[model samples]
Target: MAGRRTERIDEWRERVDELCYDGERVEHRLDLECATVVVTTQRVLAFVPTTAGPAFRHVDRPNVGTVTLETSQRLAVLCAGIIAAFAGVATLEMATSITVSSAVPSVDLEGIAPLPGSNLLVGFVETVLAAIETGLLLLQWSVLLAGVAALVAAIGLITYYIRSRTRLLVVRVSGDDDLVVPVSGVDLEDELVVDLEAAIRPAPESTPALEAEDGRRTSSRNWTEIDHEESG
Candidate 1:
């Protein structure tokens, strides 16, 4: 099973690599259950695996105007609904058990003495009532336990969902279009943003070099003009 999963991941990675430019190399790769994301020197590529085939989205670093991250609440909401349903069922079971137990008549076992056949009859009634009460108590407890289990599960689910849920990375493109990518980890998002910024922003040192070259060219032009005047 593990081998097969690894093979599938390799296939997805290959698909992502295919979408990159000729010389672009992947700097970071994040593999999600439903999708795979790769950050390259030139662009960010997201590949979603589906029943039909793999779907892909590419966001060029230079075209990304802004990136925004937001948390998703779908899993948390679903877990909350499950917890509420379990609690409701437990409450109903407890109320039903209480009403049923109260409706049954109680026997005065202590007040009755050894009255031959009458004692046997009273003993049987007491035994039957005890069994019924025991069953009701067991039923109530089972329901309560189920509710508690559901509550624990819901709490764990909420905690995990809050911590590990995919973050929405909205990339606003140059033409006002948006490219939404579901990123899993905070570190991955930070790296992606850093790469994007690096790609978009020009290097500060390049400006100084260009200015110096232009100054040298202007000086040479003046020197040439002075030589031409002397020759004339």
Candidate 2:
């Protein structure tokens, strides 16, 4: 598992490397289950690749603001949705089954001649229930497939939660969405966080260099005055 994680990080680092402009160097990167946050000298970039193509969001280092750990309900909400979907699928299947099974007659209708017409009625009811069950089964098929997908998503998110070391970093930026990176397995406590906070922090004011030559100017007016006094 650790080896696979390394490979994944390497792949993202390559991708982040490709997107970097000439002379821009990657300093720190936080790899998440669904996205990657990369900090460079010039800017901070968040990448989330989709089926369509690669997606990107970034902020210049100057614009990167205060970074704080915000409590996240994203995992909780997703888990709830997955649980609800499974419950719905089970409930639907249960209801359909109950309806289907109840229509069968306990006594044999074929043996009684006086209730010949009654047999047809029972057969009609059974046929209707069967059709309903078929339709419900198709609906359940779709629901079941959706439930499985949710389950997979839940598992992935759970992995992310554990690997993040129970951390949620929210990178506040100016004029852009905050970079909410769900981190993956990496002990970047001293290195990565400092790099990001440095971006957020205002740069220290620089004092002007005193490199210019400082001297009293020998003015043309002073020369003219001296010449006039001499001529006088």
Candidate 3:
């Protein structure tokens, strides 16, 4: 009876080994809780403190990555303010120069004191118009810059959202365990799936025989060879 039980155990071990040797195993699961996103991976479980819940856990698969979101309004307003300030300073400088030049009595208006007053008033009004034009130009530039910044930020946020919530899957043949690798860099999220698939490729036909030969060589190297010819 004991022999039978031993045989059964051996058979069971062999079955498990065979299943692992010829199995397709790929899986991923992801979840979320409040501010923290829980990413779980199959077979590659990480041990955490019991206080955090279960001691063993894995990252979430079949889910997208993480995204940090923020509003660009502050940056936009800052840019608009800077543009407006620069335009204000430039307009003030140009207006001052215009006022000074207007005060220099031109020969055309030298004899007519009242006409000079009218001309001076006209120059003052023109300066105000020029200042207004500067303000308008600054406003237009600010709007354009703000629009471009918002567009860029929106596109970035959208891309982040899509990638974060994307479903990632893995497929493997056998082994009760799966490995989930955190991928980074350009276009690596999708590439991770390909890499996982490649990891399960069957070993070459001669690999096992070669491994056996290597084992023999290693054993031989560990001990001196006994030869009758050397003894003679």
Which one is best on lDDT? 1
The TM-score between candidate 1 and the true structure equals 0.47
Clashing pairs in 2: none
Over 4 Å off in model 3, which ranges?
Answer: 1-116, 168-232
lDDT of model 3, residue 206: 80
Ranking by TM-score: 1, 2, 3
The whole-model C-alpha lDDT of candidate 2 against the native structure comes to: 0.64
Rate residue 39 of model 1 by lDDT: 65
Tens digits of per-residue lDDT for model 1, 6-52: 56755866776666679987776766555666768777676654323
Give all candidates' CA lDDT scores. 0.67, 0.64, 0.41
Error (Å) of candidate 2 at residue 50 is 8.9
Q: Write the per-residue lDDT of candidate 3 for residues 111-175, one digit (tens) a residue.
A: 45467477786677667766766675665566556555555555555455445543223222133
- For model 1, state the Cα shift of residue 145 in Å: 2.6
TM-scores, all models, native as reference: 0.47, 0.37, 0.29
At residue 201, give the lDDT of candidate 3: 36
